[model samples]
Target: MTTVLYFGLFAMSFDFISGYTGYLSFGHAAFYGTGAYTVILVANGLVPLFPTSTPFMISLLVGGVFAVVLAVVIGLVSFRLSGVYFAMITLGFAQVLYIFVRGWDYVAANPRDGPSVGGTHPAGFEIGIPGVDQLNLAIGVLAGEEATVLGHTLGSTAVSYYMVGLVALGCYFAMQRILHSPFGRVMLAIRENEERAVAIGYNTYLYKLGAFAISGFFGAIAGGLFAGFRRSATPESSFYFLTTGDALLASIIGGFGTLAGPLYGHLFDETVREFLSKSGQGGGLLPYLRAGLGDQALATPIFGDMTLGVLIDTLLNGHASLYVGIVFVLFVLYVPDGLLGTVRTRVGGTLADAARDRFRDDHSTPERTEGDDE
Candidate 1:
């Protein structure tokens, strides 16, 4: 599912920097929105001027590049702050971005439209380019264009699903390899203890900034996939703390600092939310008991959802921060190591012990040199 893939990528990207480096960037969504906006901005010309230039692909790359640059900038600004200060500054910056995007009337009025095939000669006319006269994408302005490919109608929502799925899987494996690399080990050291890492001659700032930039770069790629595939990138989706929150929720719920935890987390959150929303379609006791009874059940809308989003969107759905708060509380209260961390501690410790014992036994062999050694 795109839902699973999207949030899986979300978790990995967030954890790649935040969980690994211990920076805990709250404004991480800025990079993601930046990617979406970047791609959309880059490909606007290609669709109209050079229709066969593959704007979609260019948009993805541009989005990723923009994410990397923004991450660098974000790293520079917030690298000085740590813990609460880092979180505060990150949150502040995210709000600033959200407000700016929301206030911009041009993008708001028009929003960003997707890359469309524009034509010169109208009425089902096929035109060829000057130099490359052979290749012509003569698409008719006929009915049901969206459902067909080259005059063949095919039910192809599955294509989008598979594409996103592969992208997410690629990112996941790549991240896993990176996490196991020497650089990733250094990042873990920095996360475990920045002072000790610095004392040991590690450039904490560089590593942190590098991790942040790389994480954000991938986050933007994911965002671009989401935006381009969806064909509609809105301000709400692009610039928001909650976007980051959703990723955080996925990370936390599915077990942060693990290989595929966020993927599971997305499934959990999306399934529960979707189920609750679709099932809660009636004016319940709270609404009917009140004076106003027009089949409207909630006081306000939350992230375009009814019920719970309306009830506590302010304190709770500020993204998934509210829900994650409860989860964090539970995690701290009971499982301090997180789900995967807990499992690794139990299993990895035993494996290490066994390996150590084997090594000791291998070296401790009563050497046949008992008579030769002095």
Candidate 2:
């Protein structure tokens, strides 16, 4: 759930620019990776950029700044091109970064895969609230050090979940505020018609650059949270174009332009995946199906000695991705506006029609005065 929240926040960052400005960036992961690496490096005192050990929260902010700087540089070059050319340039830049991280041991300790920053205190990148000794962010279970909140004992993972969720919520609201501002309106105008926006005295290039920087800043924050949660950073996961692709997918499915929709979309995606994996486990859907079919039928051998139950479980576990892809295709064809967008359109139209009818009836009916009655 924490992972979903951070990923949702990241997706919203992408939507803030791509959804609003219609410029689909394919290198958003560059900012994400920069954030992850910066946060870890600063927190661990691995980089001389910060003296001594930096606070976790402070490092996160610094990481965001780094991403913003990178965004400015990338935007200057990438924004020069429009449409598919822009996307390809961004993608090319991200791939170059990926290759650099993978091959350079100076950048990442384990260049082939990535860097590892997880372990016990004093060894790993330990994050916690400033001046609060009791509250520390640790991934997974923290045995013998569990803290109770509101009479409920919360483990390390729960603590991380709450912290990350709160940060994600803050980021979501911030993006919402930005999207509702005048600058955001300019971005929308640029998206609708860039040439018209330029004719109207708005510098379209500057507006796009600003939006890209904002998006990159938030993306980095999400990356910082992710790195802290996972206690590691990998070029394959963080710098890969597929990372941006996942966020893009979430945005589309959740409803682009709705700041919080991606969160719901990501949550739904995660839920479906969890359901698929657990369906094959001991008390899951597979067991229920087997029980309903009974032993003889399940053992009836659909292929050679392989039972029906085995086949079903195998498909559920192994071909889960295949099923997800099919569902995505269906959504694209039938529900192009996305889940929330479609819901809002239908619900809003219905309410508007109802109100119009009510207004017509009320106005059409003449008031029965005393003289008229007589």
Candidate 3:
């Protein structure tokens, strides 16, 4: 799903800074919200830089730049404080922005409701290269304007999915490459032991700042994509501290330190939530379970005013948050290294040992045959 990919990118950004530098940022959503608002403002011609609708690509870059600017300011101030102190400061800044947005109607379309790009375009949210309508992506399946593709009437959403997905994939690979470089090695070194790094002449603070900035840049880009996908930017979705919290949750579940882990974790998280949300619908998990359980078993009350079926149904309806929290707690207690990390530690070692044994068997000099020994 495009939405999942967009959020995956955001989670990866969170992991980039926090996982590597051990700096937990509680205001990462500030950058995300900023980028979304920047893209929407620029695209809607509200910004003076573009008298007309800005091209989608340019808008995304501008959004990222704005986020990076915010990151620098936040990092400079927050990095002065380490650990929890730094996190709280970042959170304080984000809350300030959230409160300002919620109360300011002159800038926002509505203080409580937030600003939207409007539903004038039938195709959910779309972005086009300047003067080239054909080169555009609309980010919904059948919700957008119909376009002919290979004799099929496919909406802009299908095309947009591919476009956005490709961008996300490219961003992931780029971050991976960065993490494998010499700079990445320093980042790891800093994470492993900041004091030792400093003692060895490495400037840990600068590296942390750099990591934070890079994280902000990627986060903003993801936000821009989300704006384009949803065709609107909402303060509640953008500036809410929960957004950052969700990213943190994903990174922890996915595996910290590994660049790809958060991406996979987010995808898994989104998929589970989607299923849970859909379970109550006609074609969802609830319907199938209800059918299998039959009317009698379902209606049998397990407790006063609550049937066994009702409890299960209630959980299937809107209990994703509860489930996620439970999973997080269990992970923290049992699998501290996280899903990917645990797998790497367990399965990876087994495969590695097997390979080593095979290598030894192949490379070891064979005992001389009886005749050759003679």
Candidate 4:
């Protein structure tokens, strides 16, 4: 679930630009990688000027700022063209970065494996107010601090979950506010019809550039959070194009234009992935079936050499991608608008608005009609 929150933020950032502006950023992982690498590098004292003692929050902010700058640079050239050409150029840039990072020795002794937090910073990354120790709490699976309230004790994992969740929630609301602003409306206009927006005297190019930068900033923050929690960053995980592909999958499953949809979509994705994982990280199907069915049932053969257990192991174990792909295909064919999107369309307004209207109708006293007076 913590993984879902941070990755969901990344997906939301992707949706902010690609979904709203109708410009796919195939290389969106570039900013994500930039942020992750920045956090790890700063922690390891590999980055110039920024010492190992730099606050985690400050490092995250610096990474986000760097991503914004990189976004502007990429957007300046890519936005000049539209459609697939722009996507390809952005992807090309990310691929180049991926290769460079993979081979760069400055990041770690083995750059291909990326960098991990060493003795320089043994503590978990703090997530609350920067300067106030009381207001801030550390977040990590093993490095986080635990607390006991009433009779219940919260473990380190639980603490990290709540802290990461708080940050993810804050970021979501920030993006939501932006999407409701005039600038966001302009982004929608550009997506709907660029030529029409241009005819109306709006500089679609600049709007796109601004949106891209904002998206990149948030994407980097997501990356920082990920690196903070894992205490490591890898070239394949951070800079690979497939990272952006995962975001795209979440966007499509969640609802491309709806800002919050991606989070729920990613939640669904992670749930399925964990359930079918071979490592049994979350008590996967293989373990469950093995435990539920006795040895007699396990030994029952369905075919010449394959028992039911073997069949289940072969097909369901670690094959989450197959089922997820099927669901994706079904969603594309039948539920094109996506889960939240279809709900919004059916309700004829935002979900919050619909709920408010329903509440008013249910509670408010009906007006006295003329017939009632008679």
After TM-score superposition, what is the CA distance of residue 363 in candidate 2 from its true location, in Å?
22
Local distance difference test scores for all models: 0.65, 0.78, 0.78, 0.88
Q: Which regions of candidate 2 fall more than 4 Å away from where they truly are? A: 110-129, 132-145, 278-284, 287-294, 303-306, 349-374
Where does candidate 2 have its weakest 10-residue lDDT segment? 117-126
lDDT of 1 by residue, 170-263 (tens): 8788888888899999999988888999998999899888888888878887777666555546667867898888788777766666757667
Q: Quick one: ranking by TM-score, best first? A: 4, 2, 3, 1
lDDT of 3 at 143: 51
lDDT of 4 by residue, 1-374 (tens): 78898999999999999999999999999999989889888888878899887888899999999999999999999999999999999999999988887877777746454543323354448888877888777777668778676989888788778888898898889988998999999999999999999999999989999999999999999999888888888888889999999998898888999988888889878887888888767888878988899789989999899998898889887788998999889988998987788889999978999999999999999889889977
Candidate 3 residue pairs that clash: 123-144, 140-157
Please report how far candidate 2 places residue 133 from its true position, in Å. 4.2
Question: Can you give the TM-score per candidate against the true fold?
Answer: 0.68, 0.85, 0.84, 0.94
Clash counts for the predictions, in order = 1, 0, 2, 0
Compared to the true structure, candidate 2 yields what TM-score? 0.85
**How well is each residue in 1-374 modelled by candidate 2, as lDDT tens digits?**
87898888899898888889999999999989988887766655666767435666777788899889989999999999999999999899889988886676665644455544432224233455755666655443332134688899977777777777878888888887888799989988988999999998998899999999999999999888788777667777788899998888887788876667677777777766665654544254555676799888877788787888788777665565677677778878888877777776876743446679778988896878889967
Which regions of candidate 1 fall more than 4 Å away from where they truly are?
A: 46-52, 105-154, 280-332, 335-339, 342-346, 349-374
Best by lDDT: 4
Task: Quantify how close model 1 is to the true structure by its C-alpha RMSD in Å.
Answer: 10.7
* Cα distance off (Å), candidate 4, residue 75: 0.3
